[model samples]
Target: MRIVEAIGIGVLILLAALALLFLRRMVITRRGGTIELGVRLSTMVPGRGWSAGLARFAGDDLRWYRIFSFWPGPRRVLSRRGLAVDRRRAPDAAERLVLPPDWVIVRCVTRRSPVEIAMAERALTGFLSWVEAAPPGESTPDTRPYRYRAG
Candidate 1:
């Protein structure tokens, strides 16, 4: 019947729309990284809610993610210059998205470079722990040292 055919066409159109949306999100997500690690940024959502959802998502993902900061390390300090920097503007290279905050930034180094990812994992873990324990109005120190060092 014509109604049946129409319904099928409608369903196909809906599916195509969804697929395109997902693919677009994927492309947007994949746009940034570095020689050391590729970074991904999530859409700006409230930090608390986003963090909670990410913790749950990580339970299912092979790669782990956690909130992190650079602090208390002698070489690392938080300053305007240190946080979520665009990597491409460096003296030597073309433009690239270096470290945009994702609900999680996956360590995207070549599979051979397990060391790079491991270090990021450790720092992220420490930052997560710090955020959980930090009390209201407690001063959180800078994490620029560690982030800069990693880059």
Candidate 2:
């Protein structure tokens, strides 16, 4: 009887935690158009440093939040002024198994720092649009257009 009661309590706690995480995700996504993607936070190791995240385009800044986090703030914020697209590529065979079929990997260059963002094709389109958009008097990252290749 004691063992059964303990198991029941543990299951209830787990469910509550899951519900909280779901609520947090809903709140985060409700604020704006959030694009789901995988962000490489660092160059730790192969298939190790990548984390699933949600990115929101807020004017000149892109705010990224971890998908499965309890925090209410963005984990990273990238400014469009310093961001530039380096290249784009389709995920390899092993990565295809883990990520979505339509997802593409984009390498972004920002003040000598390189970051990789993996997102769906449509999301990539929206991201590129935002990166290219600017105010009437403000210029984009560069004058030359970026030719992206999916290799």
Candidate 3:
């Protein structure tokens, strides 16, 4: 019985060590701040009970996205210039989003404002509209001058 107990303790220690290593890896990646797009949202399960949707504008590409295990409510969105927040109501107030497998989160390393978010949403919608209406091989003009960068 004593020997069995000792083996169990050893296994528990090994599991704890592995868990620590995994956490460390995640921290290192976050610190790197080197993602393909400057604007990439790092989302987690919002809370015990909540769901929200996320959308990103890749210069006219309106990629409707979502996040899960995230929190909602009056949260500040950050950007390069500073905070351009919006007093959200209901759907707008959704800070934490529960995204589906098909959707993804595209957030900036920096904070953002409601205006910026609106702009991104608009641009993406417009771009999508144009793409649907345009000729098969034609490309739409990349009118978006601002680059979404997360700090």
Candidate 4:
């Protein structure tokens, strides 16, 4: 009877902790000026495919947070200056499971390291605009003129 009561108390404590974590995530996501969009992230490593998550545009950088993580911080940050879009494509069969439906993947090189991001077509347009819109008096790393390409 004593042991059963202790076990029940422990379970309740764990449940309370999980509820607090969920509320914390909700508050941070809602108050951090976050953009709620599905994003798939991939590194340059061979055979390591994409992982989907939520991307938040914070200042001049984009922060990506894992979908299943309980933490309230981003796992990756891509700066505007170092980001360069290399190509765009539709996700393969395996990638479809991770990414949102009809979303396009944009392959990019940032600080000479390759990264892939997936987002909706409309969001991609906004992302391109954000990247291209450098502050006045500052030149973009890619000094060449900007041209939109239809994929």
Q: Tens digits of per-residue lDDT for model 3 on 1-151?
A: 9999999999999898777655544443453321211122333533222223333333323333233212322123232232221221112223334322232223222232222222233243343243234343443233222333322
Q: What's every prediction's RMSD, in angstroms? A: 15.7, 2.4, 14.1, 3.4
Model 1: per-residue Cα lDDT over 63-147, one tens digit each: 2223332121111112222222111112111111233333123223221221112123434554434323434454334412233
When 1 and 3 are scored with lDDT, the better candidate is: 3
User: What tens-digit string does per-residue lDDT give for candidate 4 at 1-151?
Assistant: 9999999999999998889777756765785645545543434544245665667777778988776677777888888777777778877776776666868877767776777777887788788877787677565647312433446
User: Against the true structure, candidate 3 has what lDDT?
Assistant: 0.33
The best candidate in terms of TM-score = 2
lDDT of 1 at 68: 32
- State model 4's lDDT: 0.70
Candidate 3 C-alpha RMSD relative to the actual structure: 14.1
Poorest lDDT segment (10 consecutive residues) of candidate 1: 51-60
Roughly what TM-score does model 4 have, to 2 decimal places?
A: 0.73
Stronger candidate by TM-score (2 vs 4): 2
Off by over 4 Å in 3: 32-151
Please give the ranking of all candidate structures by TM-score, highest first, separated by commas.
2, 4, 1, 3
Q: Which residue pairs in model 2 clash with each other? A: none
Better of 3 and 4 by lDDT: 4
